[model samples]
Target: MIDPTGRPPAEATGPRRAARPERLEGLVVGLVANPKKNAEQFLDAVGDLLAAEHGIADVVRTRKTSITDPIPPATLDELAQRCDVVLIGVGDCGSCSAAAVADGIAFEAAGVPAAVICTDAFRVSADAMARLQGSPGYAYVTTAHPVAPLDEAGVRERARQALSDVLELLVQAPVPVAAR
Candidate 1:
C-alpha cells in the first residue's frame, strides 16, 4: 500500500483531529488538468466558478503530460507555499485522479490544505470523498462530481461545490506546523 516515499494509498484513514476555525484570508485553488485536449478548458471553467462563487483569491493551474505520471514536484511545492488550500481535478480520468490525489497529499504534507476532485464518471463526488477520507495521502481529501461530462457549465458548478467543501474543511482542520 505504501509507495516508495512511504506514503500509503489514499484510502487509509487516520485519527481525526479537533476542528479548528479557518485562519486563511483567501483561498488558493490548484487545478490539475489531465493531458486530454479538453483538460485546460475544464480547468479554466472551474477556476472561473471558484472566483465568482467562493471568492477564491488566486488560481494556480498545472497540466500533466500523461495520466500515468505525477505533476512536477516544483509545481506542487510552489502551489503549497502560495495557496492555503489546493483543489485538484482529474478531468474524468480515474487513473489521473489517483495520481493527482497523491500530488495533493504531497502539498498537504508540506503544510498546505489540499483536496482532490475525482473526475471519474463511474464514481460520484460523494464516493470520491469517501475514498479520499480513507486514503493515507489525502487524509483531508474532498470530492466534487459534475452533473455530466465536463463542459463550461458543469465544470463551473462542480468547481464551485468542490471549492466550497474544501474551504469548509480547511477552516475546520488544525493547521500542522512545519518541522524544525
Candidate 2:
C-alpha cells in the first residue's frame, strides 16, 4: 500500500484503511458536496435515509471549492473532528470522480470513514484515482450516469439505489491490504 502522498509506506505491511463504525445509531454523519448539479440534493436524500433507517444522529454538510481537487486538509480535519462517518459524491464525470475518491481516502486517513459516490460510467476513473492516491481498489458506491441531467425524482431514485452501498462502505469490515 502507498501513503496518501503516493509514497511507499514506511511499514512493510503498508498503510491500512480506517476502521469502520460498528453501528450507525446516534452517529454524526458528514456530507461533502461537489459543485455538480444535484449533488447536494442526492446527499440530502441519502442523509435522510440514513437518519431514518439507521438512526444517524445528525448531519454536517459542506461543499468543496473545486470539483477536480481534493478536499482541503483543514476541512478534512474539521470533518473528522465533527463526524463519525462521511458521505461524499455525485461524481458523474471524470474529474469529480477522481476528486471524490481522493477526498474519501484523505478522510479515512484522518480517522473518519467516508463513502464516495460516483456514476458507474466513471467507475474506472474513480478506481484509478484511488490507486493514484496510493489506495488501489479502494471501495466506493456507484450509481447510474449523467446525474447532472437528472430530475429531482431521478436523483432521489439514484440515492435510494445507492443508499445500501453507501452504508456498506461506511460500516463494513476493513479489507486488509494484503487481501486485495
Candidate 3:
C-alpha cells in the first residue's frame, strides 16, 4: 500500500530520531487511538500503566476520526513537541492495524519513541503497514484479536498483557538515526 502522506515509496522519509530517555519518570505520554471498537479504552489502560508505574506526569490523547487515516501531521507535531513517548493502537482489524503502524511511524519520524500495538490476528497487516511506512522491521506488540466483542475489563486485560512489550520497545529499542 502507498503511504498515507501520498509520497512515493522511495521518497517516504521519516525524520531521524533522538534516543529514548533513560527513564520514564516525569514524561508525557502521547496516545493516538484509531477509532476502532474500543481502541481508546485499550490505549488508555496502557497509558495508565506507564503513568502509574513510571510516574508519567501527564497524557495527551487523541482519537482519530477513522481507523485508516494516519494521525494528522499537525497532531503529530503537537505530540512531538510535548511528549517523550507515544503509543497508538487498537489494531484489531486490517485497515486500522495499518493506520496504527502508520501513526507509530509518524511518531518515530517526529523524534518520539513509539509503540504500535496490534492484535494477534492482524500481525501480517501490521507488518505490511510498517514496510509501507519505510520501517520494514518496525517493532510492534500485540494482544488477542477481535476487541470489538470484548468488555472493558477484557480490553484492559489485553492492555496489561501488552504493556511489558510496549514498555520494552519504548524504553530499550534503539532510535533510528536519520539517513545522512
Candidate 4:
C-alpha cells in the first residue's frame, strides 16, 4: 500500500527482502536543474557522477520553467514514463529550493523515485525531506547539499551521496502491503 510519504511498502522476500535493490539496469536517471547558472553546472556534474561512479543506465536533464510553480505536466510525464529516479538541485534560493522539493514530491507521486539537493547553508534539506516524508504525495524523500562555492567535485559528490541514500532507504524500508 502507498504510505503518506507516497512510497509503496517494502517488498516481501530474498536479497530484496528488506528494501528494493539499486535496480539501475535500464533505469533512467532524471536531472532537474533549477534555472540558475550554477544549477546547470551542478546538474551536469551530477549526471557525470551518476554515469561514472554508479554506472546509471540513462540520464535525462530538464529545467523548471519557473522557480515558483510546479514542473510542467509534459516534463513530469516524460520523467515518470522514462525515468526510474530523479534528482533536483535547488540553488541558493530557499523559496525556489522548497518549490523544487515540492515538485520532486509531485514527481514521486507520478511514480518516479526522486530526491532534492539543497544549499548547504540553509540546512533546510532535512526539513524539506521531512515535509515530503510526512506528505501523502511523496514517500521516499532524501536530501543533500554541495559544499558552497559550488565546485564540480562537491556537487557531484553530494549528488552521489543523496542518490545513494535514497536507494538505500528504498532497499531497507519495509514495503507496506496495506494502506496505513
Candidate-wise lDDT, in order: 0.56, 0.84, 0.81, 0.59
Residue 143 displacement in candidate 4 (angstroms):
7.9
Q: Cα lDDT for residue 30, model 1?
A: 67
Cα RMSD to the true fold for all candidates: 6.9, 5.2, 4.8, 8.6
State the displacement of the C-alpha of residue 118, model 3, in Å, after optimal TM-score superposition.
0.6
Candidate 4's TM-score: 0.65
lDDT of 3 by residue, 1-180 (tens): 555545445333443344677778898888888877888999899888988888899999988897877788888888899989988888888888878887887788778998888888988888777777667777788888888888989988888889889888788655568843
Candidate 1 lDDT by residue in tens digits, 1-180: 223223344545642333333644466666767676455665577567667765778887777777646667788777767766665655355555556655655665667665555644624332443345464323434434433455666655555566555555556755568642
Query: Clash totals for all models, in order?
Result: 8, 0, 0, 11
Candidate 1 wrongly placed segments (more than 4 Å): 1-25, 120-149, 160-163, 173-180
Which candidate number would show the highest lDDT if scored against the true structure? 2
TM-score for each model: 0.63, 0.87, 0.87, 0.65
Candidate 3 lDDT score at position 2: 56
lDDT of 3: 0.81
Candidate 2: pairs in clash = none
* Model 1 steric clash pairs: 10-135, 10-136, 11-134, 11-135, 12-134, 12-135, 20-172, 22-171
